[model samples]
Target: MSPQQKALILLEKQGNFKVGSRSIPTPGTGQLLVKVYSAALNPVDYKIQVDGIFVTHYPAVLGVDIAGIVEELGEGVENFREGDKVLAHGNFYMIDQGAFQQYTLAVATFTAKIPSSQSFDSAATVPLGVDTAVAGLYGKHLGAGITPPWAKIVNDHEPKKPIVILGGSSSVGSYTIQLARLSGFYPIITTASPSNEDLVKDYGATHFFDRHLSASQLMVAINKVTDSPIRIVYDAISLPETQSVGWGLLAQNGILVLTLPALVKEDEGKGRKAVHTIGSPHLPHNNQELFRSSWGMIEKWLLEGIIQPNNREILPNGLEGIIGGLERMRMEQVSGTKLVAHPQETK
Candidate 1:
């Protein structure tokens, strides 16, 4: 490996990203310089490429999720060292360390050892999805009351109420269903295309309603399955129509959690809590702890084979692949699939 290497860079104020060479970064305190083997692309990447929401500098790298081997560790980094295989959710808002490059730096708390049994591409897909799902589920106290029967029997306590997952076929939605079920919530209902009903059910969704169904029809389907209304709702697809249907199914004490902002005004009189899950800021003391715990849980699930990586299709042209991939993603509505790229191929 050289002291400097080529990377795919998104130039500031430019509509497109380009392949270029830059000095390889040395890890700063509490960070590891990882030799990236695989990188996963999310819808957010395309949005940032076009809208430039969180980027602070020009010619920045654009990937947020990566999996690879550690080549160097910064001073005070104890949990990892050279040659350790790891998966990281690199900070996108940071100018120097984004993952769409041959080598990227990541903070210790935001990374975890990759399960030996998983491939680099498979490991790459877990961090962002896991973090988003965990944050939405536990960070906001969505299914906190739900405890598994084994846990209840051991602890001698009752289970928590049920929660609903909208858009269960999406990558985040799929994980949300499994996590909710793992927490011991009963009747984990979800809405998705009819074609995905079986797949969602396989992931612990107790019941599936067609997203194409009318709101009244959807509510009726949910009611026939469980008398207990949805106590907590995670709207993975936070569209106006979906929110209307989700809010309609909410039980009196239920809360609604959305990945995107809720466009509709909340009726304080309705007695349901509605909140959006925002990105974590650097200043809050608890943010690091929350981020670490989320990675730990994801690692445990990956090792145990309880949660599997979502389906992925590799983009072959490396850095040159972004334009076509982003275009396809926008036009095709890539539901329930992940796209990945390998930067080394571009060189």
Candidate 2:
């Protein structure tokens, strides 16, 4: 029999999560069999537990952000070998690719080496947040369709235009702020609670507004900061209320990128676009070429501090700690940080 590993399993659809044993999976072509040291929890994990979304397989392991050591490499893999630390965006469609396990398979194209200066917990936070941010900015069909900063012909020129992000303190929002800075969107504005103002600014927001501000108030305030039209609004919150606010702030021919489904009514022929982004690179719908292009740059960016990993809150009891962490996320208690679990410490 193959070596077995302990994993947190969702017993059934909209069902309980429990630690169970499963055979460790093997790496396939262009894949790495990773011994996942740290797995970060996202809101989607809790949603999958209760709402039964994303996963099609029962008794499924559900985690998307993975950071670990390469236990073994499959055929045709060259960049990494045994014992190299790496982080990857796990695929939701395959149980073998999930992160809520002691060992899982990672697609090499979407994986990046973790810098020696970073911890597994910190690296675990990078996958989903960075992917969502880059995809929203650079993805041709699913995103706002802006030119990628990683493009070969792209210049360091910063656009004088302004952008507004609706939830600057959230993970996706924080990354969006950084990427928007990289794309040279000047006067980068965002809305968050007054308490998280410093956190948002630390992530590269040029201007921060209280999230309680009305749409009209935000527009008025933004006008004083930059005379340029707000051509892009990334709504990382994407709740109905936030969506309405972001949609209202978009200019003609502007793009409104949403992390959640669109809630606001789209007016016909106005040239405004509302796009819901799926951050998973392994998904069939996303631009795999764009994902590969961005993942290639992550290591250098991490080492240079050009990209910042989200602040981390590590949970106790190893993999078991993930359950309560996900509960806190579901209850809306977590803010401006990623909840991470050490699966290798599981008893």
Q: Candidate 2: which pairs clash?
A: none
TM-score, structure 2 vs. true: 0.97
Give the per-residue lDDT of model 1 (tens digit) for 1-347. 74777777787854677788888988889899998888888777887887778676776787778899999999999988799999998766765578788889988778888888898888888777766777676663432233332233433265545778999988788888887777767788888888888888988898888888877897788778878767788888888988887787777767777877777565657677766764332325334556666665667788998888877888897766756777788675676777888877774
lDDT of 2 at 207: 96
Candidate 2 lDDT, 1-347, residue by residue in tens: 98999999888999988998999998989999999999999999999888888788887888989999999999999999899999999976688998999999999999999999999989999999999999898889989888877774535574478889999999899999999888878889999999899999999999999999999998899989988888899999999989989988998888999988887776766689899998989877789999999999999989999888998899998889999999999999998888999999999
Candidate 1 TM-score, true structure as reference: 0.90
Q: Which regions of candidate 2 deviate over 4 angstroms?
A: 152-159
Task: Give residue 214's lDDT in candidate 2 (0 to 100).
Answer: 92
